[model samples]
Target: MSPASSDAQWYEAKVPPPLLGLAGLFLQHRLAPAGGGSWPRRAAGLGLSGGAVALMGSAAGTFRRRGTTVDPLHPDRAEQLVTDGPFARTRNPMYLGMAAVLAAHAVARGGVLTWLPVAGFVAAIDRIQVPPEERALHRVFGQDYADYTRTVRRWV
Candidate 1:
């Protein structure tokens, strides 16, 4: 489905972070797994599963330092606006969480069916939610945001 019609209204958010978030999700489910069945599919599942585990570490670190919030687009209101932990690497750990969740689900299911959740995650985060958030962060942090931007990669 087009992200425009999705619940997140991602096009409305108009944020680049969310788009990248969803792309990562899609890559995990749609492209990570290859073939229609068994061996090849299982290999993809292992790769995504491993990636998900790593994301989990990053997610935990982010929450520990920044205080995990359900909202992805309003992190400037974050308890600490952490520059350390996972925030040191990505501006949006929540999106990473969402992507990790999708990957885990695909790994658990082990088939083309896994692709659906990944696509949904991308649509939800990228098109539906993140744009307005980045703007809010920029408004709140200003040049600090610029400095943070210069320091970190959007995603790893």
Candidate 2:
């Protein structure tokens, strides 16, 4: 049987990454009420957030087109190792996009302390959500996955 088909432990996060990004947005506002980010920073933030959304959408579309599951909580349900589109750039494009959204918010908030939430989000997803997904993928895809990991980065 395929490793992904096995009854592996679920590596679900208590809070979804998007929700965490939302929390970070709120935290950024709370941390700096008078956030007057420069126009350039705000523009850059807007661009980054937009790009992140596009990256996430492309990755999800890739998964759907390949007939695989996009749910991070159920990596075991994945039927493909998706290596094109955003996957070619980063293994965890969804998570990376979420973190990028938070980082963009932080950038627009205009304070060093406002970045804390972005850091927290990245840390939580990387440490908690990514490892199990990698293991499950490795179990299922084996050497192919190892080869993919060698060629592609986890996050850029």
Candidate 3:
């Protein structure tokens, strides 16, 4: 295999974004006990969780409809530059969805301490997972990806 391919494989084997969120949630549960909160806060958390699920499902469905890979680990396999549906809003909708879910989970847990995991999850995605995928997208889609990046937020 080529060096680039090997590197891609290595990155793919690294910690996944969802695992990071799970780790954060585990830490939150261990270090911070859930506290009491108002009903509005819980309702907001549920709303955020629902929105995250919808966004992820929409993005995945778009990928399926476009005949493209939804696997984040294999962005190099993307056959098309999807710029519609959830992609129109965020360049990384799935990652954003994961972050949103983490945030919602934290909120629902009813402790400010839960946010530590949310922050860690976001940090991992922003620092570790996203840059490689962005690079891969740019390599695959070139100027079109650049234009899309110019218009869409990474996470929104």
Task: List the pairs of residues colliding in candidate 1.
Answer: 8-128, 10-127, 10-128, 15-131, 18-126, 19-126, 22-122, 73-133
Over 37-91, each residue of candidate 2 has an lDDT whose tens digit, in order, gives: 8899899899999988998899999999999998887786789989998899899
> Could you tell me which 10 consecutive residues in candidate 3 have the lowest summed lDDT?
29-38
Error (Å) of candidate 1 at residue 2 is 29
Ranking by TM-score: 3, 2, 1
TM-score of 3: 0.88
User: Which has the greatest TM-score?
Assistant: 3
**For model 2, what is the error of residue 18's alpha carbon versus the real structure, in angstroms, after optimal superposition?**
2.1
lDDT of 3 by residue, 75-108 (tens): 8889999999999988888888888887887777
lDDT of each: 0.60, 0.83, 0.83
Candidate 1 vs candidate 3: the TM-score winner is 3
Name the TM-score of candidate 2: 0.87
lDDT of 2: 0.83
Q: What total of clashing residue pairs does each candidate reach?
A: 8, 0, 0
Model 1 / residue 77 / CA error / Å: 2.9
Structure candidate 2, residue pairs in collision: none
User: Cα deviation in Å at residue 47, candidate 1?
Assistant: 9.8
